[model samples]
Target: MTSTVDTVDPAAAEATEVSRVVISLLKGVVYQSESAQVWTLLRRFQARVTDHMTVMGLDLVIDEAEGYAHLRQATFDEANIPRLVPRHRLSFRVSLLLALLRKRLAEFDATSSDTRLIITRDQIAELLRVHLPDSSNEVRLIGDVDTLIGKVDELGFLRQVKGQEATFEVRRIIKAYIDAQWLADFDARLQAYLASMDGDGEPRG
Candidate 1:
């Protein structure tokens, strides 16, 4: 007995497959190449899907220099009531590190490109160590610094550059997150914090 399979149009089947793949990929955190693939698949569709996504309160942020993209919640308008997402509370150390990194970036922007922006691990340690309480526990201090570094890395504010355990790229995204207004408001507090650190004996050399 011969069996006959039901016939389906090849083009229709391909289109259906592409649609499914694109939708699955857009579930969360889409990058530029992924977005491009989605655009390719949905171009034939009537809806402006990207615009629709924006209307739904998501902003597609693309960093061409970094070659990455991700969706973020759009800032709420004063006219509309606020909607809150679960906030990630950073520790004091992490906050200090972020501020310092932003300040470093500002310094780089002011200086000429001919001068390389270089900050050593020791300098970072020194900058932070004073803020922390003085304890004979050397291991504990090192662990704290490591934890702070890990936190920054997770937030995409710092990228590990070449060299084992040394050197990191302070991502440009930091400037966006830590804006001028916040820095200006915190300047006096930061100055006091640094002065307090200076009052204490210098951090381990």
Candidate 2:
């Protein structure tokens, strides 16, 4: 039996890892807490990755302080010759929840000195309850609200605290995705949603 010896080039191996990291970023946001490999690779190769993405009409948005990064389209333009990154369309209710969460986070940051904002499932429900239309079936409404919280959890904005199943730590990186401009638009959307909730007990428009 003959065995072949394969030699891997150090430079080529690193380039491959860097490329993988970049591709992963393209897929979605990369949090330093998610993987040590990705965080190391990103910190090392961010400049190269940014330049490469710039060619594709995408920008690398990195919050080194927060240790999270993601890609966004270079500009909001109607003339789309080709786009590498796709836009995310959130449901009206989800959008409202995110706005509320972001607002709560801001308030937490302003009032408290803690770096992390920890909140329970009940607290989150109460926060949303006021905004939602009155529903006769309390059980159904609470269950639906629980599902909404799961959606936010899946979106990476809220991380379940270690050893605490019912509590979550709100990641500050939310500010990057939902910015002031988006918040300004949120008020109008909220008003429309309230108007739509007149009879249905939930938003229709």
Candidate 3:
């Protein structure tokens, strides 16, 4: 006698289907359990996904150290039809600050320690002051830095550790966004910006 197979439960089947999509979303990225939305499909199957998305020629940029992930298209040679995504435009100041923060994080990673990457407000001020124009602009500069900091925090590039007003945890996701090649290209631009600053400049000193 042949046995009949029972139909799967509708709810259970739907959950399983969603789980597969979630796994695909997590490909090549380290997802933090706390940050991920509990109800979201991506959070459900994050653990089982590990494969990179190479078929569509996209690089899954994930910084497990920073707890963030984003998709970036893979670079293609001129001989191959170059597929490109629309690049988001960021203000020059914002871009500069992000680059500096990424550089600092890279430096922090090179050091041997389990200590978190921390930077003081004063340190950030100093870094930016050297690259910004000097005048009676100290107050304005501070405000500008504060704005940039807020923006970076919102973008998940920096996290303010509790009770640490002057310090912030620079997220590792910055490294993925600001890759080595981009930094190399911006080196000269940074140098030029630094050279534009006044010798007698002091940021709230």
Order of candidate numbers by lDDT, starting with the best = 2, 3, 1
Top candidate (TM-score): 2
- Expressed as tens digits, the lDDT of each residue in 1-205 for candidate 1 is 9999999998887767555533543454334443666445454342444465456665555556534444566776554744322356875557778887788777787785632344656666775665555555334555577677778888877767677466676666676678878777667867665444433223222
* Predictions: Cα RMSD each: 7.4, 3.9, 7.2
* TM-score, every prediction: 0.57, 0.77, 0.60
| TM-score head-to-head 1 vs 2, winner | 2
Q: List the residue pairs that clash in candidate 1.
A: none
Candidate number achieving the greatest lDDT relative to the actual structure: 2
Residue 135 error for model 1, in Å?
8.0
Clashes per candidate (backbone, < 3 Å): 0, 0, 0
lDDT string for model 3 (28-94, tens) is 3334544455224444433332243455565555555556555566677754755543455776567
Q: Which residue runs does candidate 3 get wrong by more than 4 Å? A: 1-59, 62-68, 73-87, 137-139, 192-205
